[model samples]
Target chain A: MSIVRRLGLTFGLPIILLAAWWFASANSTDFFFPPLSEILTALKDEWFGPRLLADVVPSVLRLLAGYAVAVVVAVTLGVVIGTSRTVRATLEPVLEFFRAIPPPVLVPIFLLLFGIGDGMKIIVIAFGCMWPILLNTVEGVRAVDSVLSDTARTYRITGTARLRTLVLPAASPQIYAGLRQGLSVAIILMVISELFAASNGLGFAVVQAQRSFAIAETWAGMLMLGLLGFLLAMLFKLVENRQLAWYHGLRRAQRSS
Target chain B: MLDVRGIKKVYEGKGRTVEAVRDLTFTVDQGEMVCIVGPSGSGKTTLLKIMSGLLDPTAGEVLIEGKKVDGPPPGMAVVFQEYGRSLFPWMTVRENVELPLKQKKLPNARRKELVDESLSAVGLAEAHTAYPWQLSGGMQQRVAIARAVAYEPQVLLMDEPFAAVDAQTRADLEDLIRDIWHRFQVTTLFVTHDIDEAVYLGQRVLILSSSPTVVRQDLAIDLPDERDQLNTRSSPRFAELRAQVYSQIHRPKADAAEPVGAGATAVDGGASGYGAAPDLP
Candidate 1:
């Protein structure tokens, strides 16, 4: 597809939805449902200034720290698990059990251990976000083609060189799939973690606006969070495109021929 | 300088025991190109795997220069049949070719030089930046050849490397292999189901019987040094050699290498009959 057409496909629905929301709430009188103009005004007043720095910076940093931890730990563990049948058999069921527990449920458990500090919130995000990436990495590593592995072996490309040139690149497509899933999980956990016994963050700000009945500001905070999530996803997609160019190109070549 | 000493492979899996290769033995001399031919289900791949140290034989061993190969030897390289899967799709043609050289720990200048020379040798000089998947099947196989060539191994092993490409491409690759074999003088073991390919590229063709497989005949190719796609293939000698190999594969499984070919006459319209085995059966 042409870039213009792809851009149209991506942005077309959101533009229409935003326009619909603008007119639908234009004459609203309910306190919960405010005018779009009021929400925009609230957005500017609430976050387009000093508060943006004080709250958003810390929230984003926490999200990043937790996400980095998740990615590193998951991929490392995933490779170990993927490479060995014994390890996979022993740990997979336990990992699946943990995965089934909703991440929000763990926020309380982490809070009990760490208390309501940055550590608790960070752990909450990290623990919540690790599953998808971990599982995907295992699947990817396990699925590395046998012919490629044989070629590597016969050529004596062993140890770290084998890992870097063969295993990692072969498993990256699926790892990226996991990373994408984990991103959304991290964002959600970031908000939910702040909602419990937290004084400042994107989630805290939203709750504060709600408790004090700053309805428009509360709506604005949510709008900002959604937009933030959208922006992060777009950034991730950019990186994925650059990284998996070969995979995509291969698929294209295969399909056309 | 490669030896298969009493190699046997039995695949025991899924409540069944299948003997893939049964007591096979052969040898390839230094700087010689030998092709192994057999019908389907003849355990050709299993034998190659055992020889290449990718898989262990149930009994026996492969030796390079009289040393037992317990693992993939540092002085050998393999070009697999599935060129699509064998070449790393994530790497460009140059990167794929240079990877094994890097493993060999050659310095940067020499590595680049070998990669460049090998790529050009296989007619892939202009495809350095292209990914393996972006190239045609033949081009991808050339990249694989370039990789094996760049490794500069004492021995090179290929398993049906041209099975996937079109006929035209296959002919080109066959010539390329013979050209590389002559120039570098790397002892090569080429395995293929195609009798014509085996006859064309090999100095000697090792004809294998059906599973449980064994060497049926070790026939030396008597074609001239100068060979081409058109003239060499149409030669009566080429037809005669291929006919012998073709017949050998179709015959009932033989438990031992046969002592034949001495009394056989050359094909029709040929004055110079081929000689008997230069080495013992």
Candidate 2:
């Protein structure tokens, strides 16, 4: 599709959604079913208010910290396990076992250990995010073309130099793919952890507003969380595009032909 | 210089051991261009890999300048058939060419000069900043060639480097390789299944027999050293050399129904047709 047509299609769905939401709430009598206008007012009030900023800042900080930790640990472990058959064999089963366990299921355990503080939330987010990045990294490293590796070897490139120049760069596109996947997971777990146990953050605000029967306030919180996730994802995509510019160009050329 | 003596390769698969190469022996002198040609499954690639130090021979040793080659040698470089995979997609042409120079620890100025010279020689100076995927198949192969040449290795091994390109591009690449070979005077060993390419590119071509391969005949190209695709292909000598290789390759299969001695005689006569050229040391 043309760029303009794609843009129209994107806006088309949101327009339909807004219309449905407006129509449904217009005839409702319950105070919980506020109109779209009231919900918008609440969103503006909450977003522009001090409480909203405070919650956003803490939530963003935790997310960033968890993501950074996940990236470092997963990439390091992925490279080691990916390149060594013995390490992969020994760790595969254990990694699979851990990966299959849902991050929310471990919240009680983390809560006990870290005591329901920011530490517990961060740990939960990190645990949830690490798998995709680690597995993708392993696939990326293993997917490096053998011929390129041989060429590097032929040029006397070995050890750390080989990893840095050949293996890592060759594997980066896939690693970035993993990062994108991991980032989405991290966002989901961040909200889940905060909603389930946190005293602050957007998720906690949503739960608080819901309990108070302030439907507009709850809708505003949900809207803010959705916007945050979208923005974070967009930011990650921007970084990925910059980092993988060459790979994207190649893909474009491949598709065009 | 490279010497391969009693080289053997046996691949163990499932429950059987398949002999890929057996007791192969040959030597390439300094500054010589030697081509190895054989039918499919005749282990030409296996021998090239062993010679290039990419693979170890099961029974014998490969020596470069009288030194045993147990691994990739410092003075040797290889250009593989799949140029697309051999060149890093993430690296620009200049960076790809400069990588080996970096490995050699060459000074930046020297490395830059060598890279520029090699790229210019291959007519890719304008493409220095372009990534491999941005170039055509033949252009990518040129980058691969430029990379190997920029390394300034004492010996270069190419395994059917032009096999993946179009006929026109293959011709251009062939000429480019010949020009580089002449200019650099680096000892080159080229392996190809194409008889014409083998005769056209090499000063000498080694024909190998069928499975459990051995050198059947080593023929020297008596045609003038300078070559052009149109002029050389039109030459009577080129046709005679190609015809001789064809007979050698097809002789065993065609004579299979003949008496054993008769088939052997046909093979001997075919070998002698191209073997009349003066030998290299």
- The top-ranked prediction according to TM-score is 1
Q: What digit string (tens of lDDT, one per residue) describes model 2 on residues A18-55?
A: 89998888767778778888888888887658756678
Give a tens-digit lDDT track for model 2, residues B1-281. 57777788999899999988866767777798888898888998888888877888889887787778888999999999999899988889999999989888999999999999999999998998999999999999999999999999899999889989999999999999899999999999898999999999988888877667767666778889989999998999899889987777777654433322222222332234223323333
Residue A61, candidate 2: C-alpha displacement in angstroms: 0.8
TM-score of 1: 0.94
Q: What is the DockQ of each candidate?
A: 0.81, 0.63
- lDDT, residue B7, candidate 1: 92
> Could you estimate the TM-score for every candidate?
0.94, 0.92
Residue A189 lDDT in candidate 2:
86
Would you list the C-alpha lDDT of every candidate in the order shown?
Answer: 0.89, 0.86
In model 1, what are the clashing residue pairs, if there are any?
none
Q: What tens digits encode model 1's per-residue C-alpha lDDT throughout A144-185?
A: 999999999998888889889999999999999999999999
List candidate 2 segments past 4 Å from native. Answer: A1-7, A23-28, A255-257, B253-281
Q: Which candidate gets the maximum DockQ versus the true structure?
A: 1
